[model samples]
Target: MKTFARTMLAIVGGYVGTSAIIAALAGIAVAAGGMERSEAATLTSMLGFVIYLAVIIWSFADPALLRVALGLGAVSGLSYAVVLLLARAPV
Candidate 1:
């Protein structure tokens, strides 16, 4: 039961972490005006699969469950927060 719960949490973490990271990166690129919006969108869309794979692998590779949960959760929160902030800010 405990292992199952941990696995579930890992899956969720990987999903959230990868999505948040990608969103944040794309948002920042667009908001910062470093690249064209269309280009940023394209790059992020393509990169998402790689990021997702990495997150999934990392989730299972880590031996410590606490680290995986907390680390991924923190990363997700930070990335999403930046995304939200950028959303409110004028581009």
Candidate 2:
């Protein structure tokens, strides 16, 4: 039961965390207008998948359940803040 709980938590945390990170990055890139919109979309799609895989591997490999949760939560929260700030910035 404990193992199952940890696994589920890790999966959820990784998914949410990875998504938030990707969104934050993509938003920043878009706001900066560094790349063409289509290129950004393509890059985001490919990079998002890679990030998800990495998060999954890391989540399960790390034995510290609390660390996994807290780390992800922190990253997600920080990412959210960054995205929000970027959104409000003058374009």
Candidate 3:
């Protein structure tokens, strides 16, 4: 049960964290290239999926690494949130 919770938390954290990173990058790309939101969302979703897989693989292979990974993932998510907000700020 504990392992399951850890895995679930990791998966969710990784997905959101990675998606935020991708979203920020996509936002920059959209601003520079004048891309549509739909296109940027699709690209971000794909990147998030890839990150999910990588994190899941690592989590299953090494349970002991879950704590560190989760901590780092949380930090990444927070940083991404800050970047997203800053990127969306009005000039």
Q: Rank the candidates by TM-score, best first.
A: 1, 2, 3
TM-score against truth, every candidate: 0.87, 0.81, 0.60
Count of backbone clashes, every candidate in sequence: 0, 0, 0
Which stretches of candidate 3 lie above 4 Å from their native place? 32-36
Candidate 3 lDDT over residue span 1-91, tens digit each: 8787767766876666666667776776567667787997788768777876776676667657657476657767775876667577773
Candidate number achieving the greatest TM-score relative to the actual structure = 1
| Residue lDDT tens for model 1, 45-88 | 78988987877777778788788788888988999999999999
Q: Model 3: clashing residue pairs?
A: none
Q: Which stretches of candidate 1 lie over 4 Å from their true place?
A: none
RMSD after CA superposition, every candidate: 1.5, 1.8, 3.2
lDDT score for residue 47 of model 3: 78
Better by TM-score, candidate 3 or 1:
1
lDDT of 3: 0.70
Ten contiguous residues minimizing lDDT sum, candidate 1: 5-14
